[model samples]
Target chain A: MKEAAGRRRQSAAASPCAACKLLRRRCVQGCVFAPHFPAEEPRKFACVHKVFGASNVSKLLQEMAEQHRGDAVRSLVFEADARVRDPVYGCVALISSLHRQIQSLQAQLALSQAHILHLRMRRTAAAHLASGDHITSASASSLSLEVDQTARFY
Target chain B: MKEAAGRRRQSAAASPCAACKLLRRRCVQGCVFAPHFPAEEPRKFACVHKVFGASNVSKLLQEMAEQHRGDAVRSLVFEADARVRDPVYGCVALISSLHRQIQSLQAQLALSQAHILHLRMRRTAAAHLASGDHITSASASSLSLEVDQTARFY
Candidate 1:
């Protein structure tokens, strides 16, 4: 009895139409057989399987492409790269490189301005010293302390 | 008559009160004179010839300081910076430093992202080559024909 039931299940699973499989639509044949087919049958033969038609494959591919946007973009880039060849690719590459150079230049400018400020501060300190007016006490104290340390070492 | 006229001019400028000079308000007993007094006597005295007071000097200084704002800022920065004495000055300095650091970090991040994208593109290129695809003779011919001299050398 178990052998006969397994044979029935195998026939049902193989019976699903190719159109239903490609469309990713449910197979009524597969669904009808699932209830009567014995558990002893292989899982693939538990019901009739859906077949993928060309149109259904195209639709599924589009949906999958939509889902994996990043991968789709990467593949499209690869395709254009293959088709138009290197002209468009080279232009994109050049633009990106120029953008990097601009960023670097801006960063360098900021760094140079900071250095200029530092130099200005040093000049100010020197001018303050040159003027008869007492330079700020803390700076004077620090200078004196450095001198004392040197004197101790001497 | 010429000596009398010269004497009268000397008496007009030789006055201590700038207000009286400015007002064209002559003092009967004029006292004190600055070296700025005119060597030759003019036929008529005008209110404009009055010696400016400390108040005027202060106002002129204020106006000068306001006008050369950028110069004043540079001088303040380059001069002995008394930051401990001025909290507002310290805040400006600190803000400038932070802004520089932020700009530098932003540049570094952009550089890093560009590098990553480059690596990813290379990897995708390698994968494309590995996957065997049909390259028709027509497409290959076009690519060879369209290939520029720069690309060939590079």
Candidate 2:
């Protein structure tokens, strides 16, 4: 136990976390930022520190539980990066853009469905005429509604 | 100018911002939390403070531009609320859920288009047969490929 603790302390003294390195501070053992912001990924901490100050992030991490801090830090880094890129909208802009795509796709799907129904109705009418049976377009349409099964979109 | 400043000072004194109210701290004239976390919406600041800490959030807002601080706070509040609900995933869960919906919708759309093409081909073959034309199903299918235009999914 003493050997492990001494090694951990030596490791902290040798290479600090990105947050501590950039902030020019000592990264002691059990650093809150050490697990999430490794020394190698300096850019992650840089952007996050630029958007939300290093001190603030450190404080926030310290407040969170050890298990939850990693995920919380990830979320903060993502939001901070987005904020740095877009001063106003940030990640909300991506959500809105996706919403627009969904709306456009839904409209297209509805139109395709309507056109498919039209084609089916015309085919049903032609089938009736080809079988030597006389039927109005209205009856053919009813027959289509009765026989056509809803498609399972795979 | 002095009158306006006085009134603004009086306003600040009359109603401290939600963050100040909850933290039991003094809200000064240039309190960064006032505009975003209005008195009526104390819950916004409550969640944000709980997640990100009051001091950290205040410092972050102060660093941001006056015009942008409102949007930034809104984004923070939204993420904070999501984090409170789902401690690990936060708003990222919402983004992932939206992505899944988009993929499912795209699959449904492709299936619908394929079904439409099949229906159009069958109808074309039947039409050829009913018009006193003797053509094999193969030729009728080729005719379908030639005559069937792409449906405008609008």
Q: Name the TM-score of candidate 2.
A: 0.71
Q: Write the per-residue lDDT of candidate 2 for residues A5-87, one digit (tens) a residue.
A: 99998876689889889989988888778888888899999987776577767776676678888787888778777767876
lDDT of each: 0.39, 0.76
> Highest DockQ among the candidates is held by which one?
2
- Model 2 chain A: weakest 10-residue lDDT segment is A145-154
Model 1, range B92-148, lDDT digits (tens) per residue? 343345557557666655554444444434444444455765656885565445343
Task: Give the local distance difference test score of model 2.
Answer: 0.76
Error at B27, model 2, angstroms: 3.0
Worst 10 contiguous positions by lDDT, candidate 1 chain B: B43-52
Tens digit of per-residue lDDT, candidate 2, span B43-88: 9988887766787677777776898887878788887788678765
Stretches of candidate 2 exceeding 4 Å from the true structure: A1-13, A50-72, A132-154, B1-13, B53-69, B131-154
Off by over 4 Å in 1: A1-85, A88-92, A99-103, A130-154, B1-154
Tens digit of lDDT per residue, candidate 1, span A61-143?
Answer: 34443344333223323322321332222123333455576577665555544444444444455556556567778977875
